[model samples]
Target chain A: MSRRLAEAFAPGSVAAQVAAADWRAATRVAGELLVASGRTTPAYTEDIIQMLEELGPYQVIAPGIALLHARPSEAVLTTGLSLAVLEKPVEFGSKANDPVRLVFGLAAQHHDSHIEVLAETANKLSSPRFVNSLLTIHSESDFQRLLSDS
Target chain B: MKILAVCGAGVGTSVLLKMNAEKALRTLDLEAEVVAMNLANALEVQDAQVILTTPDLVAKLEGTRSEVIAIEGIFDLNEIGEKLEKALG
Candidate 1:
């Protein structure tokens, strides 16, 4: 996963200390990362937002973090990710974790044998040290470094 | 024995949970087939003994033979392991 997933969290995939009035804005910004990276189309970003509206903030899988994504569709061209850290956390109406600080936008395909990719990404985000640094991270290199060290 | 890890999107979180479940099961020194499936298709997998998921998604499966384990923090492996320990104890 270290070498294979490096492209997912590539240099331009990070946005730090962004200011958004609410979670919707926050999510839109985060989802757009996939579009900018050419991993997914804008429609996929809309799918992510629509998923939130239809299913609630179920993507807020952990405290202070939300992993945004939808099912595989024509909107997704490849497996990639975009990450965003907020200046001020916004509530996504999650019962367990209300305010989210870190948002990971995911676009995964069925092929490339990406089972390891999902596992590694989930493990890295859940690790205590990585979560701590992920909140304070200001650069893509730092984010890459943590994933690399893991 | 079989354990199923489920999420709204079968491709992402469930796959991750499948790996995490493997780790937790290893720690418990228990052997079981672990499967990851999306919520929409999970109900069809009736052979699973236990189903793991987030609280909100658990509500989708109200009455079922399989034991449903819902976690507050879906990403926390410690919480996941502890809950599984208590349930499978």
Candidate 2:
């Protein structure tokens, strides 16, 4: 069976109230979680940063969420997800979606393996109740339960 | 009708845009085929009636025959639907 959004979450990757100095810092935190989960190498983090430099703030996909990622590369050992809820929102320079508080780091080994989770996440985020729950997530368990709920 | 969702990498954000655009079209009761692709591939497609992409990528699609719509957020269904309605009408 294909991994769902909740199943694709790397162990110990969900965090709450993380402190980040800026958008780069926020992305780094998410990348670190992906590293700790054994999903990608340290180089994958830099790849994501490089993508940001090249692509601009297009990762800021919603009002308060930034989905950080790059094209699937060898740096990705396996597909996984890292989520962080910022203690203080940071600007990613997107005019429509500035002051992002939630960052999701995605590392996919292929073009399509992770699409299910991505689509699931997008659908859940469209719900105001789900967004509210995400903003108030107090623990990793809270985040996991939130994902499973929807 | 066809719509192309364009992004830098094609495989990531554009997929999200394509999904939301599908939902928006469904709500609007409009029928169209939406495809997700990278910037380079999007530029080559000639039959698409509309192209949905981020604000930054709007400039990159300068000469495409399709009408380009710049969406503020890929997940914002209301924004996508409103823009699609105006563009299609």
Q: In TM-score terms, which candidate is top?
A: 2
* Per-residue accuracy of model 2 over B1-89 as CA lDDT, tens digit each: 99999988777789899999999999999999999888889999999999999998899899999999999878778999999999997
Please report, in order, the local distance difference test score of every candidate based on alpha carbons: 0.80, 0.88
Question: What DockQ does each listed candidate score?
Answer: 0.53, 0.63
User: Interface Cα RMSD per model, in Å?
Assistant: 2.1, 1.2
TM-score of chain B in each prediction: 0.89, 0.97
Runs of candidate 1 exceeding 4 Å displacement? A145-150
lDDT, candidate 1, A52-86, per-residue tens: 78767878877888888888889988888889999
Candidate 1 residue-wise lDDT, B28-81, digit = tens: 887888888788788887788899987778887667668999867665668888
